[model samples]
Target chain A: MEENIKFLRSGILAPIKKWGTHWSLWPVHLVTACCGAELAHAFASGYDGERIGALNYGIARQTNLIIVEGAITRKMARVLRITWEQMPDPKFVIIMGTCGLNGGVFWNSYHLVKPFEVVPVNYFIPGCPSTPEALLRGIRQLQNEIRTGEPRSSIEFEKVDLGKGKMMPVTPKSPKKISLAPSIVVNVPRKADEETKKLADEISKLGLATTVTGKNRIALRVEKDELVDAAKKLQNFGFDHVKNVNVIDVPNEDKFIVEYHLGSYSKRELMPVVLNLFTELPRSEPKLKSLAKIFPSADYMEREMHDFFGVVFEGNEWMGRKFLLAPDTPEYPLKKDFKLEEEKYLR
Target chain B: MEALVISHQKQIGDKMLEGLISGLFKIFTSNMMNIPLIEPLVDYLMQIPLVNLLVALILWRPFFAVIILPGLVGLLIYLLWIVYWERKLTARVQWRVGPIEVARPIRGAIQALADGIRYFFQEAIIHREAHKIYYIQLPILAFIPILLPLLFIPAGNVVGIKTPYGIQLIVAFIALIPLFIVAMGWASHSRFAYIGSLREAFMYFAYEIPFIIAVVAMIYVYGSGDPYVAVEKQNIPGAVLNPLAFIVYIIAMIMATSRLPFEIPEADQEIAFGPFVEYSGILFGLVMTLLYEKLYLMALLFVILFLGGWEGFYVGILGDFCAPLVLFIKTVVVISVLVIVRSVYARYRLDQAIRLGWTSYLTLSIAALILGMFVGVLV
Candidate 1:
C-alpha cells in the first residue's frame, strides 16, 4: 500500500519537478583562453546551448552564470572579481576545463590565477579544452540546484595567521637584472641566404628601405604615413596574417619601437618570411598611429600593449583603458627602471 | 406502487455501493491492481461536498489541458528532447560527441539530470547593488507571461482554451516578455544590465512590427482569427499555399526569439547575457527557461501558421488526448528545423539583423499579403 502511494505521488509530482528543472542556467560570456573556441562551439551549431537554457549573454553584470574557460591570468582576475560582484545575487559559476581549476599547463606561470579564488564557483567540469557536452552538463548541474533549494558546495579558504610572529620593516631591494638576451636573440644565420637577399631586393624595388636581418627575415623601416602601404606590399608578398603586434619601450631614447610580426597561412614559397615593421615615437609624449584600422585583428593586441607599456595609440581614440592589467598598478611595470616591490611600498 | 418504487431505488443504491467496495478491495489484493491504499483514503476524503466542488471547478477542461497537464508532462518532455537534439546536432556540425559520458548507454539523456543534481548543491550569489525584491521577483514574474501564450496554442483538437481572437491574444502575451526582460535588467542595477536592458528595448521595437505583420498576413489569407480553424483551412499546408508568408514568418520567428542573426540583445561577446546577467542557480535557470518558453510558444505559432497543426494521422485512442498527438509531432518538427539552422549560420551583426527585419522581411510579408489577397480573389 505504501509503495503504491509513493508511486502515485511521484507520478503527480515528477512532471512538476521536471518542468522547474528545464528552464534555468544563464551562462556568462567570459572567455579566458583557447578553450573559449570550444566554448563557442558548444553554444554554436549542432550543440546549441539554447535548447538547455544556457543562453550566452554579453555583459557579466546581467548574466547570473560564468563559464571560466581554461586559464584566468592575473590580469583577468580583477575583471573576474568585478564582474562577479556586479551580477545580481543567486548567480552560479561553472569553471569549464582543468585550466580554470588548477591553471592546467600554465599552473606555475606567474600570470595565471585560480578562478575560484576570485569567484564562488558552483561547478568544476573536468576537461583539457572542455567540449560543448561538458559545458551543457555544467549548465544542467546549475538547473538542478534550482529545483532543490540546496547549496552545491561550500566555499573553503585557508586563512594563515601572522600575529604570533615578529615583523620588521625593511627597505625594498632593486629588481634583479635578468639577462635580456634569452628573449632577444634568434637562432638566425649571420649572413642572409640567397632567397632572403632576393626578397630584400624585391622589397627595395618598391621604393622602400629594406634590411635583411637573417635568412628569410626582412625588416622595413617605413615612415608613419607609409606603414599601411608597406603592410599592403607584405600582404601581396603572401605574408597573410599578423602573428603578433609588439611594442618595445625605450624611456631614455624617448621613443617606442612598434613592430608588427607578419606571416603567411598560404604559399609554401613565402612560408619562411617574417615581415617586421618598426616605427619610433618621441618618449616625452609617446603616441603612435594605430594599425588596427588596417588589420582588424590588431585591435585587442594593441589594447594589451597599451595596458602594459602606457604607450597611447593616437588614431585609435577609442582605445579603452587597461584591459588585462589592474588600473591601480603604479607606472608601466615593464619599463626598464621601474621596480615593482618599491612601487608597492611607495603607494 | 410508491412503496415498491422506493424499495427498488434503495436496492439499486446498495448494489452500487457494494460494487465500489469490491473495486476498492480488488485494487489492493490483485497483482495487476497497482492502485495504492492512499488513493482510496483520498477519494473518501474528497467525497466531502466542498473539496469535491473546488476540485471540479479548477479541473475544468481548459485549465487541465493547458496549465495542469501540458505545463507538467508535455513541457518537461519537450524541453529534454529539444535539448538532446540541439546538442547532438551541434556536435555533428562541430565534429564532436556531446554529453555521452554522463549516460553512455543512452547518449547522455541523464546528462541534464546530473547537472540538475549538481546545481541543487551549489551556492547562490546575490550582489549588494541589486534591488533585492525586484531582482528576485522579475524571473518568477517573467515566467507567468512566458507561460501565458501556451493557453491559446492549439495542440490538434486538444486545445487548452478556445478564444475567438486566439492569434491576437498570443501576440499580446508574447509582446509582454520584453518588458519583463527590461524589468530583470533594471532590477539588477549594474552597468551591463542597464546597457542590456536598453538593447532589449531597442530590439523589441525592431522585430515587433515585422513579426506581427507576418502573422497578420497569415490571418488575412486564412480569413479566420482562431488558430485551430486557421490551421484546419491549410489543407495543403500553409508553407505550400503561401511560401512567401512562410519565409517571412520563419525570419520573424528567429528575430522574436533572438536566435542567430538576430541575437543582438544578448550578444555574448558584446553585452553578456544582457538582462539575465545577475541571475544564478535556480533564478538563472528560470531566466534560461524563459528563452525555451518563448521558443515553444513560437514553435506552436509556426505549426499553426505554416506546418499544419494537429493535421496528421490519428490512431483512434484516448479521444481528445490523441487529437493533440499530431500537433505535438508538428511542434517537434518545427523545433528541430529551427535548431538545425544554428549549425548552418553564424550570428548576423546587430545592424544587419535590424535592417533585414525592417526592410527585407517587412517588404516580403507585405508582398505576400497582396499575393494572398489576389489568390483569394481568383479562387
Candidate 2:
C-alpha cells in the first residue's frame, strides 16, 4: 500500500515539475554569424518568445543555456573553451542548426571546429535555420529532459587499435641542418615619406638614432638606455595603440628582433595609423626593453609573444606564460622549421 | 384557358433567360473593360518610356486611384487612428494616451505610418546559408492568396465578386493560405522553416474546424450562403443575435492569421522570423505586406459577419459610395482592434495555443451552434 502510494505521489509531482521547467527554459544568445539576425527575430515583436520566459542576457556568469548557432573556427575554439569553463555548473548547451552540429555546409572547411568536442550539449536541434516554432519544440523537449533527468544520447563511433599485439614503431629525429647566413638583415635608407621624414628629422635633432626602412616605415632601433624616451616621442606623434608585438628568434645572427607594431585610432580623422619600433638583442641572453610603460594593450600581446618565442623582456614582471595557447605545445608553432604534424606524430 | 396559360409560361421563361444573359454579360464586360482601360494607358505611357515612367508612373496615378491608392492610403491613415484607439481602449481595459508622444498636436494619429516608413527603408540582410530562391519567393507568393480573398469580400453592397455563395467561396479560398505557408517554409529550406511550417499546419488543423463550424452556424441562422443576404439578415448585427458565434469566430480568425497569443510559427526571438530567416530586401517587404493583407481580409470578414456589412445609420453625401465607405470604415475599425492586440499582449506557447483551440474555442463554437439551433426552433 505504501509503495503504491509513493508511486502515485511521484507520478503526480512529475508532471508539475515538467510544466515548471517548460515555462522557464531560458536560452542564451551567443551570436556568431548572420544567423544571429534571425535568432534576434525569434525573440522580437512578431514571435515574442519572452511570453515563454526565454530572455537574452549578455554575461555567461548568470545564463545556464548556451545556444551555439554555428561555425567555431580554431581561433574561436580557444574562446569557446574558455567561455565554457567560465560558465557555472548545471549549464546546458543547445546546438542549433546543422552547422552547429557538424559544421553543416562548412563541413571539412579548415576554419570550422566541432562545438560538441568543446562542450557537452543537451539538445541538438536540426535545421538549416530552425523555425521559432521548432526551436520552441526543442526547448520543450529540453524541459522534458530536465524534469525526467534523462541521460542524453551519444553518437556511436568505432575505435581501432593500430598496433595489434606488437610494440609501437618508433622513429628517430632527423639531423638538424644549420646555415651560416645572418637571419636578421635590416634594409636602412635615409629617404622616407614626407610625414615620416619630418618626424625623423625632428628625432635626429634630438640626437636619437633612427633607421628608415621603406617609405613611412621608420624602424627606431632604441637601446635599453633610451627606450622609454623614444617610446614617449612616438606616443606624442599619435602612434597610440600597439597592433602586433612580434618577437623573432635569430640564432645564426646571435640576436632576437623584438618589434612593436603601434597604431592609433585618430579622433580627428577617425582612422587608424600604424607605426613600427624594432630593437635587436643577443641570442644567448635575449632580453629587450618592455613597452608596457607606454601602450597598456601592448602589455598582453608582448607577454604572449615572449611566452611562445622564448624571448625575454627586461623589467617586465608578468613574463610568465598566459593562457592564450596550450602550455603542452612543444616549441613555438609559428617558427620557420616548427612542423606541427611531426610534433603530433612524435607525441 | 390554354392560350392564357401558354402566354404566362412564355413570360416566365423570357424573364429567366434575360437574367442569365445579363449576369454573364456583366461578368464579361467588367473583366474585359479593365484590360482596355489599362492597355491604352500602358502603351501611351510606354511610348515616352523613361521620362513618362519617371513622371506619370502607371502604378502611381490612375492604378493607385483605382485599386491600390485608396486602400493603401486609407490603410496608412487608418493604421495610425486604429493604433491610437487600440492603445486607448486597451489602456482603459488595463488602466494607462496609450501614446503621449504626438498627443500634444495630432493626437498620436501619424505614429503607425511613421513606423511603416521606418520599416520600409530598414536594411534587410539575407544570410549566406539560407536557400536564396525560395526564401525570397514566399513573401511575394503570400500576397497573391491574401489579395485573392479581397476579391470575394463584400463591403455593404459594393463587392468585387457577387456570387450566390460568396461567403462560402471566400472562406474556401482563405483556407488555401496554410498550404501556401507550408510551401513557403519548405522552400526556405531551414530548420526554422520546417518547424514553422509544421506549426502552421498544426494551427490550421486546430482553428479550421471551429472557424468553419462558426461560419456554418451563421449560414444556418441566415438561411443563405450569399454574403449580401447574410448581412441583410443581420439587420440588428450578428453579434447581438448570436454573441456566442461572434466570439468563437473572432477567436478562430485570430488563430488563423497567427495573431497575438497564437503567433507560434513566426515567434521572433525563438526561431528568428522562422521560415523567413533568409529573406531580405524587397522579399521581406512582401512578407511585411502579407501580414497587413491578412489583417485586411479578416477585418472585411468581421465587418460582414458582426457589424452588418455596409449597413450604417446614415447614407452620407457620397451616395452609392457611402455604403462602401461605411463598410470600409467598419472593416478598418475591426482591423485596428485586431492589430492593437499585438502591442498589448505577448504570444502564447505552442501547446497552450493548441489547447485553447481544441478545448476552449471548440467548446465555445459548439455551444454557439447549439444556441443558434435553439433560436431557430423559437423563431
Candidate 3:
C-alpha cells in the first residue's frame, strides 16, 4: 500500500500527481447507516463539498477515495472489503461517525463490525452521525495527508484536568449478584381473568402442563414428541396462527426450551388471547416436531430460529440451513455459551 | 569499361537520394504558412542549416492541419479546457464555486492537468475475466477513428487531405467511433459493460440513420460534398436555408456524443459508466475522454455545415494560419455552449431516447432532407 503512495511521490512529476490526488478526491461513498445523510448534506448546496474538488462518484473501480458512512455490520464488512479491494492503487478511506470508529450505540453488539479492522482508514470523523462539517474536515485532513507524507487530526482538543479542584469520582465495579444457574422461566403464574382461567382448563384437557400466565395469556408445556399433537389440538381451539417462534438456550440445565406464541384472526374472542406453547429437548440433540405444517405462518419463523439457535425442527424443510445471517457469520450465535470476539481498543 | 559502368551506376544512386531530399524541401517551403507576426523570428531561424528544415516542416500546411491547430494538439487543449469548464459550469449552475482549491491563484484552471497526472501514475488493473489483449489495446485503437476525421476536415487552405468527398469522409469516420466503444465493452466482459455496450449499439442505430440524413440534407443544400464549397456557398448560412436540418443536426450531435439527454449508454448512476466500468487509472482516463474527442470532431463538422466554417474576421498577422485559428475558436465555443446542457437537463431513458430518435427525430431529418432539396434548387 505504501508502495502505491511512494510511486505517486517518487517520480519527476510527483508534485503534479500529489496536487491532482489532493484536489480530485472523488469519494465512492459506502452508505451503511445514518451518516450517509450527513454525507449528502456535505455535498449538497449548503456545504458544497465539490467546491474543494471532492466530488461524489458512484463506481468503486474508477474512484480513489471511499467514505464509509456509519457502522459496518457483520454482513456489510464483506461488502466494505470488496469495495476497497476493487479500487485501484493509492486509494484512501475516510470513515465517518462514531459507529465506524468504535460502534457508537451498537458498541459490543454481536453483529456490529469495526470498519478500521477491515480497511486502513485515513481519517475518522467522530459523532453518532457526524455533522456534515466534520465530514468535510475529514476530507480536508485526507487532502493534507496526500500533500505531506504524514496524517494529522483536523481538530485537536486540549487535555484539561477537571479533577484539579474537585474530588475524583470512584471507578465503578462489576455487579456481584449474577445468578450462576438461573432458572429459565417461561410459565410465571399470574392472576388471570376468569375467561383466561377457563381457557387454561380447556387446554389442560390435552393431558399437558398448563398455566395461566397473564390476563389473556396461557402457557402449555408438552413433551417433545407430543408438540405436533398439541399444536393440532390448539389449531382446533381457534389458535389459527403462530405469531412467533423463539428458542431459549439453558446451558446449566442441559436443555433447550422452544416456544411458539399462538394467536387467531379467524376467531374473534381468541384474537385478544395469546397461547404460549413450549416444549423442551435435550441440549445435545435438540430436535422437536415442527408446528409449521399446522400453522403456515410458522415456517419462516421456524427457519429463523434454526439459524440463531441451531435447533432442528424435524419436519420443517429449512431446518439445517443458515438464514437471516451473512455466510461468514459464526453458527448458532444465540447459543448461551457462544462467545463473540471481544473488541480491544489500543491507546 | 566494366569499372567505369559501375561508377556511373553509383553516381545515379547518389543523384536520386539528393533529388528526393530537395524535392521534399521544395514541397514544405512552397506550402509553408506565412505568419507575419513570426516572420523576423522565422527569417533568423532560416539561416541555420538543420533547424530550418524542422521549422519549415512544422509550418507546412498539411503537417500543420494534422498535428497543430484543429488537430491533435487542439484536441488536447480542448480536452483540458472542457473537463474543467464543464465541472465549473455545473458547479456554478448549482450555486457553487467549483474546483478552485487546486491552484487558487489561477482559480484552479489547471485542475484537469493535475487529474491527468494522477491518473497517469495510478495502477491500471486488467481484471482476470477481461480479454487481456483487446482490453489493453482498444482505448489506444479508438483514437485512430477519432484522429482520422481531422485529415479531411479542412480549415481554409490548411488540410491534411483535401477531397471532393470531405463531408462524407468525416461522417463516415465519425460513424466508426462507436464500433471501438462497443468493442471496448465486449472486451471488459463484465455485466455492466455488457449492458453498456448493448445500449451503445442500440443508440448507434437509433441516431445513425437520422444523423446521416441530416448530413445528406446539408450536402444537398450546399450542392457539393466538399467543405470549402459548403462554406463558400453559405452567404445566407446553411442554417437559414434549411432550419429543420440544422435542428435535426443539433439533436443528432447530442445523441451521438452521449450528452446528458441521450447519455443512456454511459449512465454512471444506472450502470456505472457502462463499458468503461472495469477500466481504472490511466486506462480509465483514456476511455473517459473518448466521447469528448468525438464531440470535438462532430462539432467541427457541425460548424462547417450550419455555421459558416472558418469565415470569421481574418487576422493579418496569422495570414493562412488565421483560418485554423478561427475554426478552432468557433469549435471550442460551440462545445462550451453544448456543455451547458449537461447541467441543465436530466438523462433520458434508453427506450425513450430510442423511440424519439426513430420516430419524431427521424421524421424531422427526412423533412429537412426535402427542405434542403427544395432550397438547393433555389440557391
Candidate 4:
C-alpha cells in the first residue's frame, strides 16, 4: 500500500494531485466535542476557512479531511473510527485539541479516549480548545505537506531557559489527590416539612435509610434487592421519569453505589423535585434489580451506566452490550481502578 | 433504358454523398470568421490538408455552436469561472478574501482546476453496499440531459439543429436531469441518500410546473417556441413584455438549479449534498457540478426568453462567433447576478420552498399566462 501511494505521487502528475488535494481540503463536519465550536468559527465568516480552500463539507464520503475536534469519549471513539473508515483515500486527519494528545483537562477522565487511537492523524493542533486561527494554521500545515510532500510544522520554536531568564518560583505541588476512601454520601442532614416527612416515612419502609437532601430533593438508600420496590413506590408517588442512572465505584469499601435520579414531567407539582433512589451492592456481585418498567426513560441511562461500571441493571436487556463505548474499548472503564495512560510532557 | 436509369440513379447517389462531404467545407470556409487580424492565419491554416478539416470542424458554424461555444468548451469555462466566482463573490459579501492563495496573480481562478485534478487522482471508492452498475453509471448518464439541450439552443444564426420547438425541447431535456439524480440516491443505498432523493423528487414537483408555465407564458407572448423567432420578435426583450413570468422564471430557476433560497434537496448542512452523499473523489466532483451545469443550461434558456438571447452589437470581425459570445456573456452575467442569493439568503426548508413554488410562483406564472394571451392577441 505504501509503495502504491508513492508510485502514484512520483510522476509529473504529482504536483497537480497535491495542489488539488491542498485547495479542496474539505473537512467533514463531525462535531465530536467543544473544539467543534472553534471549527465552526474557523469555517464561519470570522475566519472563513473557505479563503484557505478548506470548506467544512457535511458528509464523510465526499470530504478528504477530518478535523477530529477536541476529546473523543469512549462512545464517540467508535463513531470516529466508522467515519474515518467511510472517507475516501488520500484522506487526512487533523486532531485539534490538547485532549487529543493526552486528555488535557480530562486527563484522567473515565470516558475520554485519545482520538489518534481511532484515526491516523496528519496534524495535531494543540490548545485547550484550539483557536480558529490555530485550527487554520494546522490546515495550512496540511496544505504545505500536500504541496511539498513533506510534513512540516507551521511554526518553529527556539529553546528558552525559563529558570535563568527570570526569578522563577518553585513549582507548586498539586494540592488534590484521588480519595482512597470516599464517604460516598448522597444523603446529608437537612430539615423537612410535614408533607416531605410523610413522603420520606412512606419511602423509608421500602428502603434502609431516607434523608431530605435539599429543597425539592429527597434521597432513599436501600439494599440492592429493594431498589425496584422503592422505584415502584416513587412512581406511585408521582415521580414518573428517571432523569439519569449513575454508578460510583467504592473500591476501598468493596462495593458499588448505584443511584437513579428520578423526576416527574407527567405530574405538575412534582416536576421541580428530584428524588435520588440509590442502593449499595458488593463489588464482587454488582447486580441490581432494574427499574426500567417503572421508569421507561431509565432504560437508555441504565445501559450507559452498565457500560461504564458493569453494574448489571438485572431486568434490563442490554446489560453486556457496549452501547456508549466502542466494542474494543476497555470494559467497565469508570471503575475506580481503571487508569488512562499517563501523560508525557514534551522535552 | 432500365439499365441506363439504374446507372444514372447510382451516379446521383454518389454525387449526393460527395455533395454532403463538400457541404461540410462550404459551411466551414465561406464568409468564415472575419477577424482581420487572424484572417491571413486562418486562410493559411485552411490550405493544410488535415489541419484545415480540424479548423473547419472547429469554425464550421453548427459544429462550433455545439462543441465549442455553447457546448463542451463553453460548459468547461463556465464551470471553472462560476465555481471561482461563486466562492469569491460569496466571500466578498461575507467579508473575507476568497481563494486568493492559489495563482494569486489571477486571484485563484485555477482553484477549480486544481480541485478537478485532485478529484481525478483521488480514489473513487465504490462501497460494498452500492448497486455497482447504476452507482457508477448515473453521474456519467446525467450528462446526457445537461448536454442534449445545448444542441437545440440557438445563438442567432448558429444552431446545431433548427427546430421550431427548440425552447420546449431544451426544457424537456433539462427536466430529465433530476430523474438521474434520484436514481443515483437510490443506487447509493444509504439513509441520507434516500432522504436526499425524496427531497429532490419533492423539489422537482415544486419547481418544474411553474418553470414550464413561465416558459409557456413566454411562448404565448412570443407567438413561437423557436429561439430565433423569439429573439427576432423581441424589439422589446421578453422580461419587459411579461415581467410576472420573468419573476416566476427566475424563482423557478433558483428552485430548479437548487440554488441557495431553494437549495433544500441538496442542503449540504442538513443532508450532506443529499443524493450525492455517497459519491467521493471524481464522482463527487461530477455530481457536485451537475447542478451548476443545469443552471448554465436554464440560464441559456432564461437569456433567450428574457434578456434578448443574443441581441448585442455584432462583432463583424468574428462573424458567427459574435452571437454565441454575446449569448454566453449574457448567460454568465445572469448567473453571476443570480448567485448573490448564496451569500444573501439562507436556504429555505423543503416545505417552505415547495409552498413558495406551488402557491406564489404558480399563481404568478398563471397570471403571466393570462396577460401573455391578451398581449398575444394585441400582437
| Clash totals in order | 44, 22, 0, 0
Winning model by lDDT: 3
Interface RMSD, per-candidate values to 1 decimal: 8.3, 17.9, 1.3, 1.5
Rank list by DockQ: 3, 4, 1, 2
lDDT of 4 by residue, B179-293 (tens): 9999999999988899999999999998899889889989999899989899998889889898998999898888888888888878877887879988988898899999999
Q: Please, what are the lDDT tens digits per residue for candidate 3 over residues A1-347?
A: 77866665686778877887888888999998899999999998899898788889999998899999988998999999999999997799999999888889988777887898999988989997899989989898898899898999877799976664565455333332324578789999999789989878887886767999999998988888888888888888788999999898888788999999999999998889998999898999988888888999999999999888899998899867777887767888888777766444331
Model 1 lDDT tens row, B13-119: 99998787656444422311112433465467447745644444333445545754444457767777886778677777776665564456787676555445334
Over A205-314, each residue of candidate 2 has an lDDT whose tens digit, in order, gives 66666666666566667675566777787777666777888877676776777788766686342133345677777766766667787888778887788757767676
Q: Candidate 2, A118: how far from true, in Å?
A: 24
By TM-score, rank the candidates, best first. Answer: 3, 4, 1, 2
Between candidates 1 and 4, name the one with more favorable lDDT.
4
Q: Candidate 3 on B78-156: residue-level lDDT in tens?
A: 9999999999999899988888888899888888887887788777999999999999999999999999999999999
My TM-score estimates for the predictions, one after another, are 0.57, 0.45, 0.88, 0.86
**TM-score preference between candidates 1 and 3, better one:** 3
In angstroms, what RMSD does candidate 3 have relative to the true structure? 4.3
Model 4 chain B poorest 10 in a row by lDDT: B30-39
Model 2: DockQ score: 0.02
Which has the better DockQ: candidate 2, or candidate 3? 3
Candidate 3 interface CA RMSD, Å: 1.3
Tell me which residue pairs clash in candidate 4: none
In the range A239-346, model 1's lDDT, one tens digit per residue, is 777778887766545566788887777989778788777776666666777777766667788887887677777667556576766564555656665553422344
- Model 4: per-residue Cα lDDT over A43-92, one tens digit each: 77788888777776668887789888777888788889999988888899
Docking class of 3: medium
